[model samples]
Target: MKRPGIVLAHGKWDKPPYAIGTLADALRAAGHPVLTPELPWSLARLYDASFHDALLILDAAAQALRRQGCDRVVLGGHSMGANAAIACARRHASADGLLVLGPGHFPDWLHQQGISTDSLARAAHAVASGEQERLTLTDVFQGRPRPVRIPPAHYLEYFAADGPAVMPDNCRHLESLPLLWAVGRADAHFDLGRGYAYALAPPHPASAYHELEADHIGTPQAATALVLAWLARTFPEPA
Candidate 1:
């Protein structure tokens, strides 16, 4: 019999079907099916439309999964997509388990370097209006890996909905839902310790934290072993 579906939300730009592919494969090998949704305005307007736009996608995905007989599920995503997945779990109270990768509250790293609220609100404006192409992701990251430029609309929508400011309160209320927060210790965009201290230990202490040595942009293959191992220990199922 197939195990419960694990809903895979990708990172940034409609959280497009990235990052979770390999993890999906792992879950599938464990007899779990996966759902990776195509978020709205992805190709052209990813940046500008990300804030309010992605919510529609999430609602739709949840409904679709229910239709396919997925009442119990897992919510998972990477980077900003990770933020969306966790929020989805919070809002819908969806999933029997929750897993987050590269999630942050306040994301001090980005703000310290200067991700202004004014700028984020502006991005929200551009997206709400559907000016996606005008968006660019040139400042999407930091360090030698090169920034992943996204359109203004996508970032705007993403910020409006899932920005660090909105995340802490939602996350704090969650208790014992088999949460796993994973990141690369070498991660540059957000520090696990400072931004996710509560997520790392007890109360919600049953949560698991794994540190991959690679930076954020590196592929899942780099840390797949640890992730799968952790998942097995934390989310075991009956045979």
Candidate 2:
């Protein structure tokens, strides 16, 4: 049997490839092909691409993996990357399984926290006025305020309360596929529990939810063993 190929996306505002390096290395060392793509949310790119564009980028990366000879593909990510993974699965439904770690980035939740409301309103105004210039928007990362410059239209695509980045909504819309959602106990979003998002996803017998002892940044490394085991069990290679 062909070994499964896995594409791991890095978190928002994180440096490319490195943010998920540890987990990606583990998967590669285990004889699985891995691709760690530099997503638009990376520190260098920072909202340069719309959410849909990011999904397309992921699709390209997954296709690259298939061309590398893997029979099955798994989409996985950390933090905001995890959000993108879920949204990508909903849009493409091509991957065999999903591996989400410390899933973050919920537009509705950010609005509730008063982080994106003002910026979203401004972005809306800019969009209405036909302004094509990039606007500086406030986003929160790990409880700290992060400012990002992005075109008004693109900003709204991500920060809108009913946007595609909403985790629970994306989960709800996901196609039926095996999913492994692992969250950190010490992560800020952990308190929301699996019921907030994971439970909303279409159920599959191989789906799982794990709570780890690590914090947000540490989740990928901490869950490496669990992820490898899940992959082995869910998509075992023929002996």
Candidate 3:
């Protein structure tokens, strides 16, 4: 097979348009063909029953990559997409690695599935207050990560499930892919403890976490650069 490429996935509230394209350009510059897809109605269904749709999107990406002769892929994502990428990588015949940048909503995702985060639960009143503009969110997102003003249907679709549902768990098999979990230490929406990455612990032993001195907004750029560097070292491009 040809040298593997990188597949980048984005999270809720963000469109897969220029955001992904721009990252693709950077990865291309790094010498790896990148596959970034427009997740199926993800922007609208993030809050709805879109988890199934999200899972399908991941499958479609893999199929698309395989058809393009990219069977060996390095799955990567920003925020929520990281979760999807992990699910996708684990479902297929395994991958080179899982690179997650600025993982978000992990606490809420887990909570929906009844995995309450005491840290977040401590802020229960605030969390349920429905505060449109939360200082905490601003602190984490920096540039103001608002509740994507999409249609109610779309919003409902977005959060279709209370998650951290362990997409890989469904198949009863974990992908032995290496993992590169990068997070901005300044990210307010991200608390490593709350991320509950413990589930990702042990097993393969080919994983590492790096803390960038940036918040959620700054993570994408920095994480992109880091991913490029790692992909070059791990899945080096054609000579």
- List per-prediction Cα lDDT, in the order shown: 0.58, 0.90, 0.57
RMSD of candidate 2 to the truth, in angstroms, is 1.2
lDDT (Cα, 0-100) at 171 in candidate 3: 19
> TM-score: which candidate is best?
2
**Candidate 2 per-residue lDDT over residues 185-236, each given as its tens digit:** 9998888998999999999999999999999999999999999999999997
lDDT of 3 by residue, 99-202 (tens): 77776544334445443333243334444665433222111122343433333333322333433334324213554557787878887644644236625444
TM-scores for all predictions = 0.71, 0.97, 0.68
lDDT of 1 by residue, 1-239 (tens): 23566776666443344656777787778666677776543444444444445655665666676778765566776666666666676666666777677653243334454554555666667777877655433334433222345677545444443453255655765545777777766676445463554353224435666666766655354556665665566556656
lDDT of 1 at 42: 42
Among these predictions, the greatest lDDT belongs to: 2
The window of 10 residues in a row where model 1 has the poorest summed lDDT is 138-147
Predicted candidate 1: what Cα RMSD to the true structure?
4.5
Off by over 4 Å in 1: 13-17, 40-45, 48-50, 104-113, 117-139, 142-157, 160-165, 190-202
- From the highest lDDT down, the ranking of the candidates is 2, 1, 3
In Å, residue 134's CA in model 3 sits off its true spot by 24
